[model samples]
Target: MKGIIGKKIGMTSVFDPGGKQIACTIIEAGPCVVTQVKTEATDGYNALQIAYGDKKEKHTIAAEKNHFVKANTAAKKFVKEFRNYSEEKNIGDTITVDIFAEGEKVDVVGITKGKGFQGVVKRHGFSGVGEGSHGQHDRQRAPGSIGGSSYPSRVFKGMRMAGRMGTDRVKVKGLKIVKVFADKNYILVSGSVPGHNGSIVLIQK
Candidate 1:
């Protein structure tokens, strides 16, 4: 899979050719630098290690600084390895949003926004325990009857009780590219994507 790193730039609606309004996510796709190239005979796997987003020189360690120096690129904040990337790219090569074309289907990978601690109703879509009327009291949001009494005794594994929510690694596939701005390094894709504004995302084809 060939891909590029990008920053989420929120979403907006655009009019299509037939005057239909389509909601799309705007992303600031890379101009990523090829920091390293792994070969089968050398690293036991084929991959391209790319880097994106600038970082301060003072914040970079000596080893990483030397690595970027060898690639002729500045310190990058986000570094990722793309396995089995088919493009014939070498170290110091620059990849931009031009690699993707309009109307092409791609997959986007990102981290979802965190929702912190939550209950069963909001987390697992469980209907709250009936109503508070008829002496039901505060049991409305409770997770009812988690056990089988003397049969199972204990709560079963994989129960959908609430704990933490969100901040998960998510992949949204089959997203069509609505538009591409190569000069500005932006690509608009149809439909929603994971992550908040300015979060790092991977667009793979």
Candidate 2:
């Protein structure tokens, strides 16, 4: 399988051949240039490093600047490797949405939006204590009795507690490729993906 670095341009509903509106997440795919190729004999593994999007010189580090120079291109804002694709690709080669076509299936991976510091009710989906109709008082949102009264009084090591949520690498598998507009350098997959709008996502097939 190969992967493409892309930015989630947002989502929209588009009519399929069946004429039914299908929910799709539009992503600005490549125009990605191959920056490097790592062979197994030399690098111990095969991979193709691809660069996408432009980054200013001020924000580019020296090592990365030198890397882009080898390709005769500016440092990209994002760069990633498609493992095992090195043998077939070369530096300075470009890939685009043409790699994908309509009616295909792909896997999308990205970091989800962070919802800072959430409670057990939201994180663990715990139903608050006490019967709602009874004398619940302020115990409605409380996590009543974390453990047994006498036996094993200490809280369990893996007990779920209130903490940060989201902002984790999430992979959505088996998303249908509803549309591929190569002329526009974008593709649309049927259904949702991780991360908010404009967040970078990796699509693999």
The numbered model that scores best in lDDT is 1
Off by over 4 Å in 1: none
Give the local distance difference test score of model 1: 0.95
In the range 98-202, model 2's lDDT, one tens digit per residue, is 888778889999999999999888888998886767766777777777787688878888888889999999999999998788889889999999999999999
Query: Scored by Cα lDDT, where does model 2 land?
Result: 0.88
CA error at residue 148 for candidate 1, angstroms: 3.5
For model 2, give the 10-residue run with minimal summed lDDT.
Answer: 84-93
Relative to the true structure, candidate 2 reaches a TM of 0.93
Could you report the Cα RMSD, in angstroms, for every candidate shown?
1.1, 1.8
Instruction: Give the CA lDDT, 0 to 100, for residue 80 in model 2.
Output: 92
The deviation in Å at residue 138 for candidate 2 is 1.4
Clashing pairs in 1: none
Give the clash count for model 1: 0
